[model samples]
Target chain A: MTAAALEAARVWLVVALTLLGLFFSFVSMVGVLRLPDLYSRAHTASQADTLGAGFGLAAVALTVGLAGAGFKSVLLLFFIFVTNPTAAHAIARAAFEEGIVPWTNGDERR
Target chain B: MADADPPPGDGASADGPVDSAETSGPSAEASDADATSGPTTSGPTTSGPTTSGPTATAGAIIVPVEPTSTLRSTIAHVAEAAANDGAPALHLVEIASWRDGDPESDERAAAAERVLERVAAWATADLDDSEAPAAADVEVVTAVIGADDYLFGADDYVRVLAEYAEENAADRVVLDPEYTPVGNTTLLQPLEFALSNTSLSVETAPVDRPTRRERFRTEATTGRFVALFGLSLAFYLLLGDPTYWFDAVTGVATAAVVSITLSRVSLDSTPAIPRTPMRIARGLVYVPVLLYEILKANLVVARVILDPRLPIEPTLNRMRVIVGSGLPLMTLANSITLTPGTLTVRARDSDLYVHSLVPWAREGLFDGSLERWTRFVYYGRRSARLPTPRERDDVAILQGDDATEELPIAAADGGAVGAGDESDGGDETDAAESIDDEVTDR
Candidate 1:
């Protein structure tokens, strides 16, 4: 509650958030790199990456409060949350419409 | 939980939203064990009823609404956004929030219904591509969600919207969040909460509120322009110039001109800006939680990727959407996709078609805790999570399926099975054997 402690808490929180965001970003990289199909990779890229970017921005917001830079960061987060999965959905739906059959175990197509 | 976990759903046991009529029981009857083991064979025969059944969101894309300045943008965005392939029909929804016991509420409902019809027509006219859902079938289906539909009270207005979206089998929920009922934030709170809480993707219609430069002298916009002018003058004086006063005047003038030019056009197009301090603060809170989920999800994915054995058992999870709003639905879908070893293959009304890498991952999808968190964060409420999945025999490629690698044995067996077409049997057997060999070797 004191100024010193509050500042310290804020600093620590920012670090934690940034680190967590980076870790998720790395995980999303692995997901995109490792997952089997287009759909799976999309999940990693859209969800994981959005989270990573969101965290990083949140940390930035905390550090800056209502400054010009902080406001912009929140705006960026909103865009990612809105558009990331949406673009992925569009791609997937397009693929589905094009008759690119989903990959399944064994003789699913049969 | 796999609500309405049908006895068997698709060729894959774990598939999209389960329509009880589509559960193919007799198709996996290659043997009783095959039927039981290959629980999701999707076949009543090779071509199953499930595959042929009408998809939940195949026909319509739903948007819920209220009267607001953002109405135009909602129409434009929803028309364009839900334009998923196949160009589904549009269902415009407006929930009547009146507590049903009073007769006055019914009069209000009737008036609201008339307004809804006009809104629907106006939105349809705005659509440049009526064929977005399909050519020659462009119809605007409008509905009024009422409180009395639920066994609960009017507070369940959110639930009613969700139920309507599901019942109509509409693909998405698009709405403007500007509905603060007659400026009473409390009444609007539940609706916003419900929109976020619903499992369906909820997209808040973006409103083009003028930015700082555009808003003239609003507090949110004032800081930036002032800082520019202030900094310019401060820099002039700090340089220790003897003619500091003259330099300061020039700096002030320059800053004023720059601010005027920049503020004129405004950033109306930049994804909805948070004007209220409260909104910015809430966003700050929400982003961190999203990041935590991302971090946890990444760790999961990392484990899946690093494992030497490459432990992955792919299955589809057919999810019954609890939330009807597009933003929450999408967030949940993106989360699932982001999580290690799971991907959303298809999205439809009331069902999210996810393909998870392992059985564990598939189970995680059904756990419902994720959906609960989403609702809590977005809407400030927690509903019952996923339904418990039915007990199923774990499905995998059987040793018999693999035994096709013994080419000659399979061919001989195929010849006996398909007695008339000797060559067709031989070719089919050869293809199966080759596929088996390739899989076994991999």
Candidate 2:
């Protein structure tokens, strides 16, 4: 491939990753607002948001091209992957322990 | 796949290395070879015929045998009890599960026998090790139960054990804290619960377990230290400009300090060539599969939340998984939580309490795809293709329409929280704020 074509491909990849990240983040926001109960809200908060962060960080890594900033972004992605689910677990565990009954089909939205 | 599945052997599967019997404490480690060679008990009763019948008196103490790190400690504890209470016979029982007329029945029986005999010898040794010459008088009898039966659930194992206890007139049961009759499945909770329903007085041996922090303190080898040092220096240089002399000098200093302080603490195991690299490669392969699932589930959950009716059938389900504990368990738990529509509320032993937003997600969780993937990552592909939780009848809906809800808050908490009592004023707004913080902070 030509240098210009390769550059264009890189640009396209970064853009695609960025858009996907934004889309996931938007879904997470909607789910947070629309979902019933603390437990369900936590699902979106941990899963969708973390995925969004992953894609966004990937885009940043690609833009920086495996250099100083790129490596740091990758590290940040790893930490987010580790911590996000754990934070969600902590929240869900606390709710369950506190007797916050999860919302079911018949129950009214909390 | 469920029926065609071979009967689980005696820790001979791909997960053999991680099995508590093979890898745990010094007691379990010391008996590894001796167990395979067959029973080496000096106790007269232990050497007797398998069908010698229950000669145990009412003072007989029953200790369920498993090659756990706490096995020796449990034996020592039982010996001390025997010394104090004047118990005549100490029964070492190992439950072996096999489908009636299954081809693997003999293998299962022989494995169970080996475990039982090994434990009997350990008990005898513990007694002999003690200063009391009277300790040698405690008869150790070994029995392999449930070999002829298709023992499926925790209740089945409990039934066989209770029957043995009753026949032997053994009132007291001393449990090794690490005992799990069915491999990798956490039956201690349900086993204890079911046994409690019977006349058996069950108590876990009061052996000291390594605390979470203490788990980090494995033997610090030079290979581990060097690996950690190199990793730290690379990470440091990656963040800063490696070409700069100042960064290089500071990175070296920082890496040295980190390797010195946290080298042993950070890595779960010593980094071995081929194994470590192969695991990393497999883990990398797992990332795409996980990301694909996350995306697919995210779209599905997004549609549900975006719908006008907001179609969701939230339920809490408890699934007993056989992916071995520690890092693999954490991986499965985290992977479950990171997938949309399923949130892992709590993980106790091998049982994970997951909250699913819809039936689709609940079914997926029971299907055990992620669990199989986790097993594949840690224990290889052969161990990956086990029966799903649904097939194994190891899942229970803890809440919603189909749920029995018989397990109260205390049972669910593993006795950590209040007993069957609901804490008033849960404060929903606080929880919502935490969720908000979690999202925005990320």
Candidate 3:
């Protein structure tokens, strides 16, 4: 393929990845609002955030090329992947101990 | 008044209603159902063997008690057998003749032995039918001795038993009520006290199982795998923004450096404390409320400044805070300080001194929106008992002696007020005015 075509393809890939990232991020926010219990909400938020962040970073990397910006983006993605879930897990564990009950339809325990 | 009953075996159910040995069958089922449904009731009737046969009869075969050392292993075997029969285990520690030698040495050893045996037996029994039941275990420890040797009071024995039950997660203790009246009275009272005080699932003779809720609450949550996967995904999404990620990382690194430098400069450096889950929970609740309060305060402060009449009633007031942690208290103080017309001058345990632009703010000091907001934010639910204004005595104002107070008068020379001077009251009003001015300035 020509250099122009290659550049165009990379742009398209970035666009696609960006859209995927947006989709996951929206889903994560929805999960936070929708899930009944702190534990379940935490589960949804953590998973969606990680996947969305990963895809978003990949898109940025593709758009910027394999240089300074791209490397930094990848590093951010790695940190988020490791720390976000860890923080979520800690919060969930604490909530569980504090006796936060999971939401169930028709249950008014909360 | 009745003849003392024999010690029930591990097979006996302790939770059922007390009935004559003749009516044991029906009462046993009734008691079991009762225990399964609600809190188990403990009474003298539930303390003895349910059967009136040779096993229940007084002076019936009292097995030669083994040495205290071998008691735990023996109880383990008995518990094993009892579990096989779907029964709660029984552990008997006879503290009859504990003070045989010199009052000090012999009695202490005997007391120690009694405590150890009860503890071991209780632990072994709890392990027997646990969810992941340890190897079926029973412990029957009998400390046979003359009447005078029972040196330690029953209360001490109960205390030891309770500690053991908590440590070993034992459900119940079975004591033989066949001893002398004094011994029986002392033992029963303390046993009841221990059973009530500790978190153990206790049952007296005959042995019975605990309720289903007790069992369910103790079980670990089942969906950890799904939770782990979901969390992983969220992390990946957050990392997508390279700029934000780098900024946060750099921020954290800078914070660490600052912390280290501060530590080196002074022996009592501010530590870099991670936000605890409880604090985060409180923050989630408080941030929104704080924003609303700030908005309200800003509006009030603006009205006071803009109106030529300057309907301001500046006053210093102290408020009491009920939260326990330093971080939450700091958050509360900072939040108050951040809002217009209110500045936190001092904060001590359960008390805060605030300087308000309006005197009405004092009315709300302990009874107003901020106090209510603090309580709701700190404790997810409201309690009937709210802290009183008297509690405010503890908090004091650091500033607001009229020396630090600055009015909104512009300098007579027409020069702009210094930033330091403006900050007292003029700066905050100016900031608010500028934001509003920008909307108008636009």
Candidate 4:
């Protein structure tokens, strides 16, 4: 393919990935506030935060085309993907063990 | 006082005249009458005649009457009358009596004096008329005993107080409840038990709350955060290169500072971390000993292999060692297996079950000198003297029996006969005889 066409395809891919990342990021914030309790909120934060932040970082790295920064960004994403869920699970388990019962809608404190 | 109110003439009247048996001095009754009749404004019942009118109109005025006679009936009547009037007063009377001139009596008197002072302070503070003027009256009396005379056993003090309450037409005995004197004399428990069982109410002065400085002193340490940071830094440096070390150090420092600052802000102080230098030293020493034992066992196994006839008598024997920690028990077991002639079949608490290949090795199990040396090496000699084999065996039988029982069953189930199994019946007889000999030796 010609250089101009290749450049156009790369730019389109970056734009598409950025929009996808923005969507996930919005979903993560919404889930954080809207989820019923801490456990569910934790699940949303761990999964959506890791994935959205990872995709956004990847898109930014692709758009900039800086090798070292891209590599570091990927490493950060890997770290978040691995650690976030484990930490969230540990916190939820500890809260459960300590007898923190979840609140239901009807029973919410006014 | 108008006319010296003639002393109630019945000496045997209930409430028995406060013991005048010792000093032949003025009795508590006489002293109380003097104190009450003295124009002092401190009389608990008649603080003011003006206030008494409203209180009397509400109910019969339950004046704290002085003990008049030595009759149980009179005391009961007074108590019942006071209860009916809904006002009761404590009467403090001083009785001077003498027990024998023992120094213990003086000590007890001194202790009782301290208790009385505390009671007096409590009464002054606790019974402020502003709070509950209609409640029972409280009067305090001091009594002195002669050197040759004993008042009553300390155990009877509570009973005496209760009886005094009844005689004074009081619902509760109001004395300083300082229990230190009773505790020092080992009489507090019985006194408290007796008081708890009684119908009349008993109350103690509230303990003062801790001061601000005390709370501050309890909460001013950040040692744990510092130690945790130090540990993490040390671990990072030992395991990582320069960049990793730098990252770890920064992360740990940040965490420590954040934690310490949060604790300060929240007023939640960290607890002191116990120093375990001896335990660290033990772990350091044991790691090397275990390595050496592993090497030595390798040599012994090699030696056993070279001997063609393979003179081996496999037997299970128990060894006792004085070890307090679980780590040492693990060390001992691993050390045994590292040696050629023995393998640790079971270990629990302080007892070890070792299967030995040679009879001499079995003999070594019962040797007290070896056990003592093991103790000296593992635990410092200053800690405790090594226990004898008999003591070891007794402890083992008591605590290690369950672990020991598992060994024979394991051996039976595995059915992996040793090299000596070649001679069949002869080997079995010999093995049995050897075990019998070992038991008799013990």
Best by DockQ: 2
TM-score of chain B for predicted candidate 3 = 0.30
Ranked by TM-score, top first: 2, 1, 4, 3
All candidates: DockQ? 0.16, 0.57, 0.02, 0.01
Superposed model 2: Cα runs more than 4 Å off:
B1-58, B62-85, B91-136, B141-278, B396-442
In candidate 4, stretches whose alpha carbon ends up further than 4 angstroms from where it belongs are A1-110, B1-229, B242-275, B282-291, B338-340, B360-379, B388-442
- The sequence of per-residue lDDT tens digits that candidate 4 reaches over residues A5-103 is 999988998888888677656655664565445543543454344446756887888887755466567667656644553465456545544544433
Most accurate candidate by TM-score: 2
| Each model's lDDT | 0.51, 0.70, 0.42, 0.41
**What are the models' TM-scores?**
0.39, 0.64, 0.27, 0.29
A best-first ranking of the candidates according to their DockQ comes to: 2, 1, 3, 4
Q: Provide backbone clash counts, one per model.
A: 28, 0, 36, 24
Candidate 3 per-residue lDDT over residues A1-110, each given as its tens digit:
69999999899999999887786666556545644455435444543545577688899888887665787787786566446634654564455335443333344423
Give the Å error, residue B109, model 3: 30
| Cα RMSD, each candidate | 22.8, 13.2, 23.9, 24.8
User: With candidate 1 superimposed using the best TM-score fit, by how many Å does residue A80's alpha carbon deviate from the native?
Assistant: 1.9
Give the DockQ-based CAPRI class for model 3: incorrect
Stretches of model 3 off by over 4 angstroms after superposition:
A1-110, B1-282, B382-442
